[model samples]
Target: MENRIQLSFTVDKSLLLREAISQYGISKKALTSIKFEGGQIIVNGEEKTVRHILEKGDIVTIVFPKEKKSEGLIAEEMCFPILFEDEHLLVISKKSGMSTIPSREHPNGTLANGIAGYLEKNSSVSTVHIVTRLDKDTSGIVCIAKHRHAHHLMSEMQKAGSIFRTYEAIVHGSVEQDSFLIDAPIGRKDTSIIERRIDPEGKQAKTSVEVIKRFTVNGENLTHVRLKLFTGRTHQIRVHMMSVGHPLIGDDLYGGSLAIMPRQALHAKQLKLVHPFTKQALTIEDEYPMDIAAVLEKATIDK
Candidate 1:
């Protein structure tokens, strides 16, 4: 269960070991790690340098360096459902009110700590390489990489816009449009350290929103909406929804009423991506959180 990858390759034609490695999209940084770190490159059962020439049909193997756990992360036992798992990746369901990683304010009882405990129990890699993270108050699926190589590949995929995430939210008011795009820029608020605002000088942000249902609770209008983020900005959905006068329910920071739901009524519902190593399509979805569903069940559908 060591966080090491042993990749085997067959040389179809004559070439240097370095060139063959390049064909597999191995970066120069990985090569450097191999050379300096405790990794190795072997040819036909013998260790060899990258410059070594390889004959046709020769077997090549690359043993990636063993990974180490991040400092200051302590293992803690916490129950979480594993949505999907493999040798390289793990998809976990995160409940609301849990921080993704340990911080100064909350150093333990985090999702990372829980995962570390899980890995320790299994004697797997101790490092918790979270590929996707959610806010402390948000509930949903998070993808974790088992090794650094997998993390690197997932990072590249994210940059290429191949990693897609979908969210579900209950907003304050009934949306006028059934489907539309929220095209705006988001920037840090001038006064607050943790707040964000829609600013013209901010980075571009886009969110596609589609209404799923409209209902009334206690004579208050509400809309359940499905949202897709085209950009990863801090507090983006909260800020964008506020800008359009439809702040999410229970999102007090964004001027949402906390009368119905306690914490921002938002959930990271789904994720879509292609497995970096297996090159297979993956679509993972989390069921609607019970807290949100409970609120919706008390409402009457809007006519």
Candidate 2:
């Protein structure tokens, strides 16, 4: 499949094609790819160079180079609940127990492979670009970009703190505070490849916790909380909650109990961001999954 994007813009003023491209925020790496790789810059239906001079109202069209699909990502048939979709991006609700991407242990049955299959079935580019990801056992919303350009724009937005994510989780004990912030640095633990820990030498990480409800389940104190991320660190929520002496239920990696659930009781419930191409604000949310709902059903809210 031709995994590329074609964008056309009408020049409002006379200028060099390179200047126009710069104003459009086309990165140097993209331009280099278009030049050395397989892409075309057309001016009024004629191929032109970046040095070409343009007149007002001249149509400048750029065909991005085709993207190469990730190696070893075999397309596999699977279905997910699509929340929002457009030409540039899409949001989908993923079920628990599914990994976001393929790995050595779980290669074929992954969200990426399923997305590749979906794209192929729809006659779309099969190259997948996942922008937001969740843990294998943490079910929730995932955002994907259709092309590299969109991915680049989204990365900028994330770095600028324009992208916001909210999660719902059930922890082991009742949280006394209505709202609080966990400002800590996170880094890889020297012991394990998959584990992360709070370290003074690591990068800054912040998470905001707001108590949604206090409850009891099976004579055990349980708290349902809403969490917002201020920084994107590996296992930020799990590590931070554990540091606060309230590990999430069923999160075995962070000293949590596995009595009520077999996986982390965390779900990405909401996302807020501005559309990279349309410049419009977007808010997407997903309902709680059955397992989480079932756990809540057995609980009695504390007065």
Clashing residue pair totals per candidate (backbone < 3 A): 0, 0
Model 1 agreement with the true structure over 1-303: per-residue lDDT tens digits: 154677888899999889999887678898899889889999999999988999999999889887777888999887899999988899999999999999888899999999999988888853889999888898999999987778888888888899999999999988999999999999999999999999999999999999999988888989999999998899889999999999999899999988998999999999999898788999999997898988878875433
Tens-digit lDDT track of model 2 for 55-81:
999999899888887888999899899
The number of the candidate with the highest lDDT is 2
Task: Please report how far candidate 1 places residue 97 from its true position, in Å.
Answer: 0.6
What is the alpha-carbon lDDT for the whole of candidate 2? 0.92
